[model samples]
Target: MGCDGGTIPKRHELVKGPKKVEKVDKNAELAAKWKYCALSQEKLRRPIVACELGRLYNKDAVIEYLLDKSAERPNVEVVAHIRGMKDVKVLNLTDNPAWEGERRNAKGDCYEDMHCAMFICPVVGLEMNGKHKFCYLQTCGCVFSDRALREVKTEICHKCGDPFQDEDIVVLNGSKEELEKLQKTMEERRAKAKTGKKSKKSKGVETVSKPSEAKVSSESKPGLTNGESGGDSSSSDSVPGPSSSSKTAKPITAAGSKRSIQQMEEKSEAYKSLFTSHSSAKRTKDQLSNWVTHTPYHF
Candidate 1:
């Protein structure tokens, strides 16, 4: 198979092993179900995780801004204080309060509320300690900490790999026990694989990548792999004509560097001509008093 960006290490490559056709089929079924799981807006009554409790909107905003700035400089962790279980866990109402006041008040509109059970594990990552943690948020929302409040783009946290809630408060670090359990589950799965039996570990809604599916990820474009190295430049040349080259290749000529400026000047001249004609055509009908009314007067 062709490599994408980074070199595909030999270790990650799957060597010949006994095929677990049954498990593969099961995983395929699971993948299909996973696809369907994302299609609905309905909420299930699951365990109430403390992190899903209500959010303090301004606190979240400040935390997110700090996190973006803290990406370059390590060691800073955004920390927040948690009072009790209600603070940690929350019931995610299906009826999003954010959209509340948009329409006219109608009777019995049935804006239902549902809860998603989620929590923040306390285990810290290599870059920072466990002291700075935020509450659980929607997997798509932010988790605040000492460095900054970060939005959890994926279902899992980038650092600790914990599942966030739809509206859960999150701590930066997961509990040590939770990390140990995660590791133990992974180890158990590995061990069970040797015996040709499926592992009993909980799939607990964490996002795990399948090697086969990842090899053909639509999100990862054809020329690029999930790595830092640049993708194939030849594909960049195939678009309509030479335009893609300007988009893909590095700058080599002064003409290329000044192309945008030239385009802007041409656009500005066209706009000026249009405006001049437009004003001159209407100059006779326009009144001086209309413009003078808004002007500041000295006397």
Candidate 2:
């Protein structure tokens, strides 16, 4: 068959192979985690703090989040568990001796050290550059590699010499399983502390209530007796029987010979009007003057 001006296509152009996947650089990933803040994703600076969950963050970023949580942020979920400044501990990291930060830049160095670390483990000579697993002590804020702790096992802290348990050790940038385990331990410790406080409060309440209950019972008995006696006396006085009526009819005289000053005043003309014996009577001049001045006036 005779073909026109069009030519046939090659087999390689017609048939396509699988797409190649882009590989992530391990050095960059490790540097990002260890050398940058987890919350702000900025280069790690001084005053670095770590949360209870072992996540590193910048102190200024944490303070800003605390001041106004509603402010817009890049990664807000990273610090959701941080309630206040108390939730994080200021880390005391050791500076690496080999790090020439400003000098290296001024020299225009072409060599990039992948193993160079910003902070080094005091226990072992391991760099915190993400190749080895690292952890921090919550009690003393000391950072150490997992291998160092496993090799030299001790109950006290390697730096501070403070005693600590397994619960005090928290892994930095840990995997999902490690974080879950740490969370479980933290919750259990808090529950134990809460239960202890509740037990103490309950005991104090019981001790206090027992004495008050006893006092109330003891006082109520005397009050009830006094009330009953008073009621009986009042009831007897209310009934106008022969004996009760005669007793009430008798005049009460506290003293036998001495007369009260009120009896002397009752015989006076000024007090006689008080009993309604005289009506529409005007007071004399002497009485009016004495009433106005409240003292006798000399003529």
Candidate 3:
């Protein structure tokens, strides 16, 4: 079969064995996860954010995705759990001193380093180039390598010194199993928040109805007292409420019920004199101005 028809038989064409599974390149996979936005698939720029699953994304890209959720997106599964901006945290990245960024090799005299990253761990100084395991604190959003976290044990963040718990540490570019665990935690948190909001709303409604209930009780008690005998009126008035006692007390004055200002002993004599109602403020007949006839000689 090999020499038939003066044709060459390639090794691939003759092989009828089971197909070999193709493996993804580790370097390319790392670059995709660490150096690019998970949502838009663009190069990671300033104002980078991370979701609950520790996936990195550009802030603007995340905003656009949130704004137009109905639009078709290839990487929707990555950000499907993200509800809004509150679902993500902005990373506080540390700049790498050796990284030249876009103008890395302008002279072209030296070999370019493909593993170079713009940000690195402030504690261990490891480049965030996927070679090292990195995690960020949810409390402070400070990125640090896993090695540094294990070496230096503390509740305070290494970069910002913000106190955090074990639950606050989220792994960056984690495995599929880790991502699923993070997703489950995120769902539980949102559900807890929803229950809290509902409880607050119920409390608010109960408080608002209390004032109206008191008003109804106060109004009904007076009507019941009017319908009963004299002996029962006193017992009916004892229905305890906020304003029932104040409403039941009748004003004894027949007419001119206004209290006299002179009865107020707390006022100073000078302060009382400023008012026209004071005895001192009333003018005598001698101090009053007389009405005069208009004449040029009078001036």
Top candidate on lDDT is 3
lDDT of 3 by residue, 162-272 (tens): 999988889999988998888788889889999999999999999999999998875555444354547655664777885765554442131226676666799888887
Winning candidate number (TM-score): 3
lDDT of 3: 0.86
Per TM-score, what order, best first?
Answer: 3, 2, 1
Better of 2 and 3 by lDDT: 3
lDDT of 1 by residue, 72-161 (tens): 432223213232232233323122223233243356676532111122322322111122344435443433442333432445654456
Pitting candidate 1 against candidate 2, the one with the higher TM-score is 2
Better of 2 and 3 by TM-score: 3
lDDT of 2 by residue, 179-247 (tens): 898778767876898899999999999999999999887555433432465765586578976997554
The deviation in Å at residue 85 for candidate 1 is 6.1
Q: What are the Cα lDDT values of the candidates?
A: 0.37, 0.79, 0.86
lDDT of 2 at 24: 88
Candidate 1 local Cα displacement, residue 18, angstroms: 4.2
Q: Where does model 3 exceed 4 Å of error?
A: 1-12, 106-109, 226-299
lDDT of model 3, residue 249 = 48
State residue 232's C-alpha deviation in candidate 3, in Å: 7.2
List where candidate 1 sits over 4 angstroms from the true fold.
1-21, 24-43, 50-88, 93-299
Evaluated against the true structure, the overall lDDT of model 2 is 0.79
lDDT of 1: 0.37
